[model samples]
Target: MERPELPLAQLHAFVVLAEELHFGRAATHLGIAQPPLSQQIRRLETKVGHALFSREPGRVTLTSAGRELLPAARQALTGLADGLAAAREAGSGRAGRLRIGFAASLALTVLPGLLRTFRERFPAVRLDIQEMTTTPQLAALRERTIDIGLLREPPAHDTDLAFETVLTEPFVAVLPTTHPLAAQRVVRVEQLADSPFVLLPRAVGPPLYDRITSLCTGAGFTPRVTQHAVEWQTVCALVETGLGVSLAPASIRRIRLKGVAFRRIAPDTARTRVAAAWREKDPSPLIPHLLAALDHDPSDGPRG
Candidate 1:
């Protein structure tokens, strides 16, 4: 047999009567007269192909079928209400989840404070964070996998992504405590040009690695690279082993290695620019809240 189409109005009346078990009270709750409420329930019973309630002189009792349908009817009505609310929010540009990407290094410094502030302001917005390299972060932003990015550098390609400088961090030299240079108050990049160095991995960005090498060159000689590591922690670990010295952002000083000593790099040859990037044409309500959060600088020392 074909199922009859259910009317929303009759469904509402059925739900009310199912709960109150009295047509008079149900009508009062629905703000309708009892006669019309009774008529609507009768009509609904016809459509459903079964009597929902047994009507005696003074009392009304639900039939077995009515008991079975009550929960389902309530669920359907609740779902409809929720769907309507979500639609309204979407139309107003105030709903949906926002996915944000961040480079690993930035997560140690600025991301936490930004996230805390954003959550406080936009409690309804869902935030999803992905930690990725600068290259992949830009790619994710372009592909719509992420709505925004906190990264060390601006995008290399000319996509429609806009970037705002969030923070600038100076460079510091990391060396084993036993190394002679570790005893100096401040070390210059040129002074370490002849020392073995642990370099950032080539995949991190040849340009960035070359920039480090170029700084050494400008200091007067080529660096003797003794090891290569992908992450700042790995580079610090290698330095602790007396493998070589490395130039890293001042934030790296936060990562305490007992054998590793960090000193300011003279002339500040090591500095990295960090920015918040997003797609120019993307529309997301949470963006403004996130931007506001990123605008508030948190006073923190570099360590991770």
Candidate 2:
């Protein structure tokens, strides 16, 4: 037997009429005239192949089939409403995860405050963070492994990616508190030229590392790199243990590592630039919101 597929409008009319049981009341509840409300009930009965209402003199009651249909109609409407809400949330980027790739050097200097702000504004977004270098992060972005990257300066020209500067802090010398140069409020790069330098390998990022080396060379000395660490924190850790002095962004001062002193370098020797990059024309809605969060000053910390 071919049964008529139920329509939501008719089911709604059936439910409202069933609950009220009076044509006048049901019509008012549905914001319709009594004649139309009664006609809709008749249409629903015809479609269901069952007389849903027992018409009597001055009163009405539900039949067996109508009673059974009531709960199913309400449950279906509730499910539909919940489904629409979930769809809206996902479309607005309020639900779903964002994969972020960042250079290890920035993990301590710039990432914490940036992430805290992003979370406060979009609590439902899941942040999947990965520690990667500038060069690799480029490949990650191209390969679609990560949605955004926090990295040092990229090549001068690239059409496949877009980057925005997040922080451009001058280089600061991280020295052991006991080091003679640490006694000064600010020390020039030339002063540390003769000292054993602790630095991350140039492979980590040629732009920043080259800037550091070029400064030493311009200061008339080739830095004797005595130690190499993958992250800025590790360099400070090495400095704390009296291993060797290292150059880092001024933001590294916030680390407050015991036994390490951070001092500003000479004017214009080297600088550390941090930028957030993503696919040039990404379709994902999460990128813009993430970029806005990254645009703030980390020194200010998360907004109120």
Candidate 3:
């Protein structure tokens, strides 16, 4: 036998009527006239090929078949309602997990404040943060392992990645307090050209390491690099021990090493451009929320 298609609206009406157990009240609850509500339930029962109710003209009673199907019908309606609500929330960007990658330096400079603000505004959002080097950060972004990255600059190879400048930090020279140059208020990059330095690993990013070396070259000599560290803290520790002088972003000032003094470099030969990066093709709902939290001003030029 060919079965008739069930009407979803009529099924809803039948469930409401079954719960109410009164024709006139169920009609009111459905926001319709009693006759139409009764007609819809009759149509639903016909589709089901069974009597669903015992009608006493004034009172309604669910039949054995209606009782058997009622729970399933209610469960379906509940599931549908929950799904719609979730869709609405997601459409508005009100809920979801955001995986963010950041360099160790930003963890000291801007990340703390940004996260505090983000948490206060969107408490329901789950933020997963990972510390990664600039090179690994771009790779993670490209592989979709991270939704966004707080990095010094966008990768040169990943043209598909978009970058928004968050902060332009000037370079500062770090020296041990007892070092001879530490007494000077401002030291030129050329003045430090002859001094031994602890430098970032060349593999961290060629352009970045080159930028530091280029600044020393512009000052009329090549840098005397002594040690290559993967992270800024390691370089800072080396400087504190009087092993070598090093140049770092202004955010490094926040690190309070007892023997280290952070001084502004004269002529300002180098600066770090911190930017928020993400794949251009990826469409994550958390993008706007994270971008808003960054509060980056497009007009802020690179630090001199």
Query: Please, what are the lDDT tens digits per residue for candidate 2 over residues 26-47?
Result: 8899899998887888888888
Which candidate model has the greater TM-score, 1 or 2? 1
lDDT for model 3 comes to 0.83
Deviation in Å, model 2, residue 178 alpha carbon:
3.2
lDDT of 3 by residue, 1-304 (tens): 7857666688799899888999888899989998999799888888788999997766678999999879978887888898898777766777777899998988787888888888888887789999987888888888999989988855555667888878777888899998888999888888897789998887775667877787888889988888888989888898988899998887888888899999999887467788888888855787888888777523333432
lDDT of each: 0.81, 0.82, 0.83
TM-score ranking, high to low? 3, 1, 2
lDDT of 1 by residue, 78-109 (tens): 99999999878755546768899887776678
Query: At residue 166, what lDDT does model 3 achieve?
Result: 81
Clashing pairs in 1: 171-270, 251-302, 254-303, 255-303
Please list the Cα RMSD from the true structure of every candidate, rounded to 1 decimal place: 4.3, 5.2, 4.3
- Candidate closest to the true structure, highest TM-score: 3
Question: What clash count goes with each model?
Answer: 4, 0, 0
User: What is candidate 2's CA lDDT for residue 179?
Assistant: 98
